[model samples]
Target: MSPLVALVHATPAAIGPARTAFAEAFPEAELWHLLDDRLAADADAAGGLTPPLRKRMLTLIGHAVDNGADAVQLTCSMYGPVAALAGQLWDVPVHGSDETMLRELGWSRPARVGVIGSLDSAVADSARRVAEVVPGAEIVPITAAGAAEAASSGDAERLSAALENAARGHEVGVFVLAQYSLTPQWMRLEAALSTPVLSPPQLAAGELRRNLLEAP
Candidate 1:
């Protein structure tokens, strides 16, 4: 039997590519994309989740359960509370975008962590991961909204500039791209000549592979 998972996409973003990467890792499960209009909605520069976003996610996950998804994976790293609450409300194996990052952090690093996101929720995700993993490590979070916008429009140059701006003060440090939204242009940003970049898509995909493969 094929296990099905619902991919609740809150933004009008290219999250499918990231999920495809995850799917390649878990060939047995079928992936579904469910999008709500809320993704096009803008975030306050402060980057926190607005009520629109919370409601959006709630509605999307509800739809997923109706569709009979065996599991639900909310792919946005920024929606931390939403991720936990949705997992509990749905009673399934809900995967948060940053959950893998934290688990991986436990296995690695004492380096300064630079987090990249187009939204505040993503910054929070990386900071939370660093806090849980690095312990007293400096976590610098930056938003590449312009980059995200360009990526949606298929402009890699604009995305690169957004990364450059977000790259400020990340000298010689480890960086994590917290939002799956900025994932397409993730490679455009230069963290630090000395720092290694940590990407949520790659991390999340690996996590999905392990879980789906090991689960009985």
Candidate 2:
């Protein structure tokens, strides 16, 4: 049997595209999307990444590992810290979605990096990661005006617009589409923002390919 990649999805909106990306990128491996609204909803419910959210995510990670996932890709940008905390519990490596770009998006000029998301915590955390990798870049996090309702029901247009709108003002923008569900909106939002959008799925897919190919 081919090794299966365990996709732990934080938000329902991101689950579909994340699995899609997994399929396209790692066709040799089976992809499993285990969606958890509890973790994401807690962050949303709290208006950001709170301790409660982290605690919830930690529990979810354990559950995924117990179920026999070969590798784990956590599909949340804001829950970076939670993912980090959970790395010790499982035998398989746990990857954070925002880990895609590393510090490559950072710059010394203090460029404004807009981390737009439906959840306040994701936006804030993605910004910090940008700042960490790129020393002087400024991070501006804005929530989509009404994306949660739209995304839950599968409204791609609204999600795309939300990404574009969140990135409206930056001169040297790097938009981190925090969720997998928003991946389909890349092209549409790219036309509107004209800013660099860093997607987690494709980036992770690339890494996964290399790792798989190089595995002895």
- Name the top TM-score candidate: 2
lDDT of 1 by residue, 140-176 (tens): 7677658667767766677667876767666645677
Worst 10 residues of 2 by lDDT: 101-110
Total clashing residue pairs per candidate? 4, 2
- Full-model lDDT, candidate 2: 0.71
* Model 2 lDDT tens row, 1-216: 777777777777777777677677777767777777777777766766777667777777777788887777888776777667777777677888867656446432346666667666666666667778877666777777766666787877777666666667766656767666667777677677776777778778667766755578
- The list of candidate 1 runs beyond 4 A from truth reads 39-47, 50-52, 187-194
What are the lDDT scores of the predictions, listed in order?
0.68, 0.71
- How do the predictions measure up, each by TM-score? 0.81, 0.85
